[model samples]
Target: MRIIHLLVIGALVFAAAYVYRIKMDSTARTERVLRLHAEIREQRDAIAVLRSEWAKLDAPLRLQGLAERHLPLKPLNATQYDSLKNLPERPPSLVRPGDPDPIGAMIQTIDASADASSVTGSVPTSAPASEGQQ
Candidate 1:
């Protein structure tokens, strides 16, 4: 009877230890989550500050002032503009009149071969024969 009692007490102690360990682990995880959230918030604040500074630095007036100080530029003048009629005439064609088009000759050769093949019944034709031919 005493041995049974001791065994029950041992099981109870072990269960308590397990429950304590689980609770400690939960608390540690909660603290880690809080630390991560804080770090994320800090990063967001830093990004916002950087964006604000970028907006100030990228102002158009500031950039225009910098350009005026560093670059050698002048304003436009009306005399600089010219009409289309003042442009020179286009040059003459480089190809001679007697030169035959190679692409057109190739297309004609293909058409002739196709017609010959259709007449010889070596190749099938997509178009039906006319009633007068039949």
Candidate 2:
């Protein structure tokens, strides 16, 4: 009977200890959850405050005044805007057939001859004075 009583006491002590350990673990988890919730709330509030401050800093009137102070710009009146709507069309010049520009053609010929002479080690004659003058 005494051995049975000791066994019952040991079981009761173990149960009490298990309950104490479980309570401690649950309390630690609850504290961690509460801390995370508080951090989330703080971050949310900070974002809202930053958004409100950004909106105030980006107001349109302030932006226009800033532009006027820094840029070479002015508010457009209707008369100035109307002038762009009625400009006359310019007629294109006609190019005559077989009428290549003589000076440009001579320059291209001279450049080609220079390249050929440089590779072949000989001097190429330039267009004579008569051809040049024409």
Which candidate leads in TM-score? 1
lDDT of all predictions = 0.81, 0.79
Write down the worst ten-residue block by lDDT for model 1: 125-134
Model 2: weakest 10-residue lDDT segment is: 120-129
lDDT of 2 by residue, 1-134 (tens): 99999999999999999999999999999999999999999999999999998998899998888898999996778776546558767777465556767776786676676645354333335544346435
Cα error, residue 98 of model 2, in Å, equals 30
Q: Give per-residue CA lDDT, model 1, range 24-101, as digits (tens).
A: 999999999999999999999999999999999999999999999999989999999999999989988665667656
Output the TM-score of candidate 2. Answer: 0.52
Q: How accurate is candidate 1 locally (lDDT)?
A: 0.81
TM-score attained by model 1: 0.59
Candidate 2 clashing pairs, residues 3+ apart or interchain: none
TM-scores for every predicted model: 0.59, 0.52
RMSD from true fold, candidate 1? 13.9
